[model samples]
Target: MSDNYTKIVQQNLHKLYTKLPPDLERNLPGHRNGQEFMFNAFGEKCTITPRAITLGDANYPAIHGILISLYALNATPEICLLSPFKSFREFPDSMPYVGAFTTHTEQLLEPHVPDIRKSAALITRYFNGEDVPVQGGGDFAFTLFPLPKIALCYIFYEADEDFPASVKCLFSNNANRFLPIDGLADVGEYTSKKIVDLICDVNSPS
Candidate 1:
């Protein structure tokens, strides 16, 4: 079971929620979770609203508003269920960049879909100290960039001989490649570099 990780994350976020205005609190009890958390707020019980932060792109910037929404869900559970929420002024600094995505990313969506399950298995084996290389993992790294956007990122490592089986990974807007389970720090760096190269290549006339 996922244990409603979003809800659990919301619970954790409440402990640190701050800077909420009285009127906004009254308007929309205030949420501190992700997009879903804030969407849960709306209606007669609340009436406060603040402008959303700029997330480079409009429409689907879950990372932009997730922090504030998570807090609202945790701190003001009662009035949060008002109408569709429209405030994200109190977003936090440490909220993860991955947990609050608002939509399917075209950044790395299509190309990476098929790799998810296979890579997951490799991650499991490597983290386990099994020395298993993720399929498609070349001598360098597997820089699998999907279509749309790269909304989610993670790695699975199975327990190894010397170390307990523990999948250690983190989501990063920066990781362009995957680190081989054998030894490496990251995997997404290669993918990102390639993306940059492609951009530069197109721009370079010569």
Candidate 2:
């Protein structure tokens, strides 16, 4: 499986490099250092060149590698549209992944709302996030970019006497313009996991 993913990522990289976008820096919204493009991915430093994509000096996972390459290949000059965040169900052809998206992205964070709230500020900083006004009313909410072109708005509702803790994740209006539906779903999953990891880091004995 890993080998297959490697081939896929390599192929995508080749396609992206063949005719690199002239305005890659603006499209990717990342820094271009010579032939290398540097950006923050899932809160980690990601450097992509014609040959490979690395996150903090290590090879990025195949799935994520593909998403990054795709993001670059589809790079567009339009600014990221963050207002009017939309749910996964709002995207066309998103029905197939809606259940999994909810399970992996939202419900996955339900158990840690408190811990996540504790580290919300740190998570925002780690992901170059911006605090957004809570929409629809919630305990708190914030927007963060896991990729240069994609922004996710996360809203949290703490457990109350009648309802259990819950989480909601919404995407920037133009998120689909950057990656395909499946890729966007994976982004949600991975970003959610990264949040859980951050909470774990906070709890780990220092």
Candidate 3:
């Protein structure tokens, strides 16, 4: 991201932190201890402190920005479990700009089947090890709880005789309770990119 974007995120965080009610702050979902909040970032536990957001011992700037923005918005973890999954376009009143990213989900994974499969395997193995449920959908699928209330589903379809491998990213219908469509797009893209990178590393020839 750009320096300006980073500054903007920091500013928004500080503004939202000040406006948050004590009761709401204390009860915010996922994990919490005083002003520090915790949640899973790409399968790893991370803590959001007043000074900085840390994934283990290291600081992840991108995750830090995303988490702070979510917290500042006071995102709730109450997912609409009864609602069926929906694509970004299906979201009510979704902005037109987001269609560019949402509509091209398949194209994004067309060239990365090997890495995508590897990534999905790793996710299944590690998450199952921790008892997180992984559901099957077109080859591979799983639900990710980036925030307590926000759930993102990633589905990967294997290449067939007539079609190339593809991926679809979906969100819970109630996701609007947390961030706007733009933020949701950011979260989805970021998570997708992270998964691809992890898979590439695992499949890299040594």
- Per-residue C-alpha lDDT of model 1 across residues 82-143, encoded as one tens digit per residue: 11211111123323433222111223323343333334334323222122233322221221
Rank all candidate structures by their TM-score, best first, as comma-separated numbers.
2, 3, 1
Q: State the lDDT at 120 in candidate 2.
A: 93
- After the best TM-score superposition of candidate 1, give how far the Cα of residue 185 lies from its true spot, in angstroms: 21
Candidate with best lDDT: 2
Q: Which of 1 and 3 is ahead in lDDT?
A: 3
Candidate 1: C-alpha lDDT:
0.28
For candidate 2, give the lDDT of residue 6: 75
TM-score of each: 0.19, 0.96, 0.77
Q: Which stretches of candidate 1 lie over 4 Å from their true place?
A: 1-92, 95-148, 172-206
Give the per-residue lDDT of model 2 (tens digit) for 63-174.
8888888888888888889979999999999999999999999999999999999999999998889889998989999999999779999999999999999999999999
Q: What tens-digit string does per-residue lDDT give for candidate 3 at 1-206? A: 45775666667667656765555444345466887777665456766555555564554546447554665465554444514767787876676746666644435656787666556657544323222233445776676655555667777677889987777767777776677776677667666665666677787898
Residue 32's C-alpha lDDT in candidate 3?
A: 62
**CA shift of 140, model 2, Å:** 0.7
Candidate 3: which pairs clash?
77-148, 77-149
Top candidate (TM-score):
2
